[model samples]
Target chain A: MLKYNFKYEWLLLIRNRWIQVLTILLFILFGFAAYNGTQKVKMRTSNLTSAINELQIKEREILSQLDSLEAGHELNISRWMMPTNPVVTGNLLPRVVNMPPKSTAFISTGQSDLFAHYVQPIVTGEDSTMNFKEMTSPTQLLFGSFDLTFVIVYLLPLLIIAFSFNILASERERGSLKLLASQPINIRVWVLQKLGLRFFWLVMVIIITLSLVFIIFDFDIKTNWMSFITLLSIIIAYTLFWFVLAFATNIWIRSSAKNAITLIGFWILFVLLSPTLINQISNTLYPIPSRTLMLNEMRSIKSEAIKKQDEILDNFLRNHPEYATNDSKQARGFYQKYMATQQLIQDELKPLLSEFESQINNQHKLVNASSWFSPALIVQNSLNQIAGTSTGDYQNFKRQSIIFSKEWRNFFKPMLFKGEKFKKSDYKNLPEFRYRYASVNTYSKTFWLIIISSLILFLVLTPNKHQIELIS
Target chain B: MILTNNLTKSYGGLTALDALNLEVKEGEIYCLLGANGAGKTTTINLLLGFLKPTSGRAFINKLDVVEHSKLTKQYLAYIPENLMLYPSLNAIENLDYFSGIANKSFNKKTLQSILTEAGLQESAFYKPVSKYSKGMRQKVGVAIALAKDAKVLLLDEPTSGLDPKASFEFGKLLQKLRQKGVATLMATHDLFRAKEVATTIGIMKDGQLKQQWHVDDISLSDLEKNYLETMSYNTIEL
Candidate 1:
């Protein structure tokens, strides 16, 4: 019976033009989404490359200047602008700390639009006040990018509903259900086989279309084959979930219109309402300190440190007497006082920064704990993880960059306090920033979705007295 | 091969079929005639196991319909008033699917032959059923029953809106099935078709069987007159 059902259902769907229409629709949707995603990735890569090239050019110019000065040539530049001054070199030639986009970054635009891809962290810049968000259109942030994740999470379920909401009700409306019920087969099994075949065909269509889109877009599938396979698995599992809902509705609802309405209602609840409600609830429960208040507090601390810089340096020298040189001829410079004040400002801002961190962490925990209420949220999070553009990824980059900034500042600190000259050879030992991705378990959410879909399918297949009685 | 013993069905305070006892044997055609809201359709539904009887039992080939609903369907084929096949499928394809659901599989050639044997035209066999008329669709339904090798048939107003020539063709198809030793119980308001095809006839009114006859013993005019009298009597009594 299953074999026959599969054979005939394929025939019927083809003859009805369902397969052809679906193929064309999926191609258009996936093709456009892939194009958008790849465009965004290209822009990000270009920005990072340009920044690196600019930094290299500056370094070469500085090295040439140092060569001229060592040769005792009278340079056109001012004494303060000289590369022999460590303070001048350190403040002018900052390293570009960047987070390179991952191979699967094109799959989701996630938080990429909300944050900066690279930052030039200078020695004088405060680590606690590093601006990670780049300049972006507020309107663009309001309406997110139409990447592959958007197509899969929001539009795919609607197509499934349109394809399957009428499976059994249409038969009953056309008067064929009487004949169907008369046959020596369980109506539930028949509905299941029919929906199952449709789901199989739909999954095949998605795979083919997505593969074609990827090929056309020159997406590097060979190197990222595992990520691609995980993506396909997530899509197929999500499709199965929608198909199971369609099956349940077709069996229980008596009219095609009502079934469609009910399915659309479920879509609204799961895709639209659940994620928004969860976000709102998490925000309400674990509120973070206001950004304006933290910024104002940081500014006040920096102003007070600047006024007391001489005292701060005296206290700093008393704490670290090794930096108190025995040569009375060593004169204290402006950088020495500024560095001490920067240290004092950082120390003063620690408690407020920790409070912000704790509150934000609590919000993330709440969101993660409640994400199970919506599969849309899980898919969104999983896609972001695969792309390495999640909030956690950016936070990791910021943390690493901050530590490197400290090392960059400390490297110049000793030279400034001891009145040592900066040289071309010193460039070799300058600290470089490297970004790492946060670890993610990509398959667990997909596994849970499959399990939930299977459980629903089991419940739908289980015969109940009400269903039988309703059939009669 | 089909029998009902004191089968009754009712809604609260309203009986749809009242203690209806009837038997349809192999190689027999029994036509049940009645007006709207009569027990003819209810009896057919009960016999098909689509509706469980409130009291008593229905059997197909000595297997109780309610207890062995799935097994009983193996020996029976049904056609309702509007015999709808998958509009996207052709006559042959529709026959193949319906027969397949009854656990019968046949090659395309066999399916086409079955459609032809059921009186569907050769040209119409490959055309989509969406383009088919009422009579053409009914022929496909008959093709399905023939392919299943059904021992019994339950039809509810199967020829409600068919034209005269189509109606005559349908009667001929029933006569052919009757000769194959199929027990048929059909519910209809067409007294003429009933007389032409039935070996035995029953007239029902207001959920009760009011009259029974052997088709050989009653003329078509007599059957019509008796049916009208029974219907008008109920109206008069009310």
Candidate 2:
């Protein structure tokens, strides 16, 4: 029975040349998106690798020069010159801990465009300036990429709705509903079979397109397994949601034109309007603190600590009495210690940072919970999370920035306090930053919540066997 | 083999079919005659299970139309006034699609023969319906009903838009279906066609059946006069 239904569906679809054209167009778009994303990943990885190697060579040259100067008894002069060269202080090299694109990354570009490519860690209280512009332009961020994820989450559902919204209503309008109803199969089963056939076609296209992307990109097979599965699951559930909606709408609407219009309106509301509206509301609810305000606060703390350097030093010495009887030169070097004190004050403002971050996270939680009503938004959020290109990724970078600051302060403090010359061997001892990828398990609750909600909605909205009510 | 007892349908406040009772036996051509809004279409819709009666029971072959809808549908075929077909498909394709939905599959030769038997021209059988006339579309509809091998056939204004020649041909086709033991319930305003094809003719007015008679019991001219008088506001003491 199912085979016959499927064959019949294919015949109908073939007979309607518009559907065939639409299917071909979707396949082409999928291929194009995957190709572009793979190229972007390869180009970015190559650029970062070349930059890192060049910076490493520059660092080696500076170290050799410092060694030569030390042998000629010019150590003090070389020490003073170190701060002028960014390479000597390791400030030029960005601590880029990249979460490289997975095999399915092409499917959803997500927040990759909006975020920074690499983050550079600075020594506490040095320069205190942030670069506003990076490699990409703001225009690119605003006009997001047409990646695989965008195709699946935004475009695919529309296609499904367009194809399926009038599945039954057209029959009704054309005076064939009675003929169809007179058939041996149940109405609900007929609708399911029709939806299943279309979904089968859609999934086949997606699987083929993604498989091609994987091969072309030479994606790491073992590591990207989970991301691939998540991508597939999201696509399936998202498509199913739209199919079910079309089914429900067809049952209620009396005319094919009305069904198409209403379903398209629903598609626009959920996919396009809801997420954008929620994002705007969230931004208003938890506005990120102005970068200027944060910079001003840091500057004020630094100047205040510098002006009362003697008092701060006295307090520190009293607290750690073991250091009180050290050389007077150590005590007199309060100007050198002022930067560390200012860093301490900045660290103390952590509660304020937490408050701000918590507000944003709360807004995210609100949006995530609201996915019960809009499956498109849920699928989109899930895709972004799996791609490692969300706001959460930025938060992870911020945390890594703090860790890098601590390492930088520790690396310099020993040399500055003990009055020892910085040697080439010490450079190897400096901590290198590495970013840890958050586990997909963090989103398990959200994933299940959306799945359960969608199922519950399907069950609730679906009519019972005994109750056959014509909507019009 | 179709029956309705006190079948009533109302659209919000207006009653389209009011306490209407009708019975169609196997091999019977029951023609329901009425003016506009006389509940002829509503009766056909009820028998077809397209609409539920507000307060009555409708049965097809002893199976309740509402309770055993799928089973009832298996015994039925419906052709509406316009006989709309998938415009992109030819007559053969349209017949195949409708029959396929009813789980009936026929070979190309059998389908062509059915189309020919319904009086569709050989040249137009393979051409897309976008070029087909209203009569050609109705012939395809009859071919679909023939392919289904339905026990009951329901039609709404079956010959409303056809020319006299086409109407005569359709009346001959309905007679052939009657000989095959298929009960047919048709709603039409064409009194002359009804007189030629129907075994039993019923006149309806203001959502009520005013009269029912076997063709042998009433003369054609008297039936036409009675139908017109029943439709208008006149005192007919008969």
DockQ of 1: 0.77
Ten-residue stretch with the least lDDT total in model 1 chain A: A463-472
Measured over the true interface residues after superposition, the C-alpha RMSD of each candidate is: 1.2, 2.8
What would the per-residue lDDT of candidate 1 be over residues A194-284, giving only the tens digit for each residue? 9999999999999999999998988788988888898898889889999999999988888999999999999999999999898899789
Q: What digit string (tens of lDDT, one per residue) describes model 2 on residues A345-418?
A: 66555565566567868887777666656667777777777777666666676566556766776666555545
- Candidate 2 lDDT score relative to the true structure: 0.73
Candidate 1 vs. true structure, TM-score: 0.97
lDDT by residue (tens digit), candidate 2, B133-211 = 8888888988888998988999899899899999999999999999999999999999999999999999998898989
Clashes of each: 0, 4
Candidate 2 stretches with Cα past 4 Å from truth are A1-4, A35-47, A70-79, A82-109, A122-136, A182-189, A213-225, A276-293, A314-335, A347-374, A441-472, B6-15, B18-21, B90-93, B105-125, B232-238
Q: Alpha carbon lDDT of residue B11, candidate 2?
A: 86
Superposition error at A3 for model 1 (Å): 1.2
